[model samples]
Target: MSFFAGNISYNTKLDFKTISNPAAFYLTNLEADLDKNKIVILDNSHAFAFKVPGDIFKTVKLPKDNWLSFSYSLNFRWDRSNTYWHSNFFLYLKRANRFFPVIEPILKKNGVPDDMKYLCVAESGFTHAVSPAGASGFWQFMKGTAENYGLKINEEVDERYHIQKSTEAACRYLKDLYKSYGSWALVAAAYNMGQGGLDKQLKVQKVNNYYDLMLNDETARYVFRILAIKIIFEHPRQYGFNFLPRQLYTRIPVDEIKVDTTITDLAGFALDMGINYKILRIFNPWIRQNQLTVNQDQPVILSVPKEGYREMEKLSGAFEYTLSADTTL
Candidate 1:
């Protein structure tokens, strides 16, 4: 198959031996021009073309009263068009499938708007990431804020890395923000830039609306970034992200084990549980060290594969002995 662009003709044959770089070849030749005005003919029998839709922005939902003007459009297009941003957005979409099931319920139970989950996508890309400013987790809660929102943060454990607990803390924090601002848009802005900064901006600008108030560059673009993520996530194919169901990440099913006692050797404990140290930490990233110190009053819950421990043990072939589930050391 051959396609013509201007006067240049390119063959779309999948001959790997002839093509030195398959990726570059496909990107340079096979991808559509995306030009609104010109249509390229493929061979002599088939032709196809697409243009940017007239009501593209209107098709995706945004908050009715909030700004969806030029600023929002710019951010949306940047997210859709920039190669780096587009790849990350595709990854965020795949990760969302693994996380939203865990996050959305917490948002709903706390009365936060369902759309607010995208704020998390904006915050940390649904990963347990720690910002240089000390914000951590999928919700990106800082140390003091995470503590204030009832997340346990300390040397041995940081619930900021715990998805469910951190999401709960986020819901609490978001509810408080909503109480103060009475607008989800402002709540999002406040979430990005501290409540104090946003308050100062509102007071200085004498404007209650997020769109009306001027903020620092990061804070100014924060909500719009979130809105863009929401739009792209809702309509991924429209923004050029395509994936099969199997290509996306998924939540692993696990059994929660309650521990009220300390374990001195986490690696040994993992082997005793018929798994490995890496798998244990993968499921429980909040475990900061090789040892877990527990108090009887506040037991820590650990997640393990529900029915695959034996399979994992066989696959690993490294365990010499297996202890009872009640073993804490």
Candidate 2:
């Protein structure tokens, strides 16, 4: 009998009575075992499709002294099995299709490793989520840190919610962290727990390696969580996430409108642009309030749909623009 999947053809000679489930047999034969190490490349970048063995830490860019133990494997298994985590992971994957194009170029321009994009996934699930600790946006920069990285934050405009600017800031921040620690793993740890805290732990425990250091629960699981996410994202079908190309979220084309002056009434401005206020905010989440106050020295660029107001109308059905500015529609 011959069974075909993708580009591979399987020829098997076995009696049907020999197996309890022919479907299970074929599936078992078709999929590579998760225990085995195999190399998979995407966009010319190397990644392991399966778990990394103890012997080959360098393949995944782990430090030379690194060891892959049961703890790391357990974390990977835990995420793979957790339904809640899978749900979020699926959403993150879909959102990545929309956001990665905007983010990856900035990372490449800054010479940061492309894999660092997964850290953004671990941080915010590719959404502008505000953490309980007040860390906000895709890269999850706090108010002070966001400002320090050149992201403007105020009542009117918080550039932390701006995808391009925040990603650029993240590249700068990641490069700085890498310079300080000289290890991408340690840079990720510092990003999660703050450099000061990671530095304190390194000094107290007298360890330079992230894997070897004893740290807080969140910090300890941090890198492993990122790794688990990376593995699942790389091998989605193996982990049971199946999606057609059409099912994935896509980026919407936009036209940039530069405004050097303050808009006292954003709703009126949206009406002028032939889009609703809600649609305006949907594309430009960095605009915090109903009104955007722009400085002449620093112009704010807003994105409207490239297909014009019709695209915006498609996103949000036609509604009466008669609501008061303070109505909060």
Candidate 3:
């Protein structure tokens, strides 16, 4: 009796109509209902999961946002062949509540699109801890590029891991890329491949749109992946993800202290602050060394979590104790 139960006859074969029927999309995939309150994951490897609401199938639209839809076709796609292809997007959506709220003010302050916040996911899965061909930080800037964008890269510290500083740097970079390409989609493509590379490809292929260009696999799929993320994130219920507000990542309270001078031992510093060294590193991951040495007076802000989550907040802080270049030396 589900309105969604119909088979689409495509060519010679019948395509099971998961998307065509709204009621079927909701009822048949009983396990995927948005209100289920279960942490369902698109992939086991990427550590991406969402807590579904118990009554998601019964509900039509997201609670507050009407701009978002419940249409299955617009909402979900089967990417069983490639998982990470959507991890960049899924992880971003799961973490949007925490990191995104913080990113909005920064983007607004710098005059960028609210949508551009997804660039972090496109760049490095909102993980300040990442290493891809020497790119670092959530924005995924190389050492040279990070320096060009006014981020300090050094042994004692790398500001690329600093969310605010790195986001500011990303805003500047994105704005410039926008000025050059004049399209946000193209600008996103250019982020993966350099502007010069994009220019060469465009000229060679005689195509300006991101989808048309023949380029490296990573760059080719980049824009689509972002779009996919946007679609899934904007319509989680449609894609079979459901979650209550409390189930998603929440903002943590923190206290910031400025250290203009270097500390001989970060471990000792944490003890003095009445917290463990492990906790210290959790908040200020840019701290690469056990001791911070300030050769020439430079100030760095350290964020210490209020309590109870640093040891347990594994997913919230994306990268912990991952290898990264120390530009401070």
By TM-score, who's the top model here?
A: 2
Which stretches of model 3 miss by more than 4 angstroms?
Answer: 1-91, 295-297, 307-329
TM-score for predicted model 2 compared with the true structure: 0.77
Q: Which pairs of residues clash in candidate 1, taking residues 3 or more apart in a chain or in different chains?
A: none
- Tens digit of per-residue lDDT, candidate 1, span 218-277: 877777677666655655544445454555666667889999999988899988987788
- Give lDDT tens digits, candidate 2, residues 40-149: 32344222233433433444665445446535644554444344475676677667777787887899999999889989998988777778888888899999989998
* TM-scores for every predicted model: 0.75, 0.77, 0.69
Weakest 10 consecutive residues, lDDT, candidate 2?
1-10
lDDT of 3 by residue, 92-165 (tens): 55567667767879999999987777667767776765564778888888888889989887667788888888
RMSD of 2: 11.0
Enumerate residue pairs that collide in model 2: none
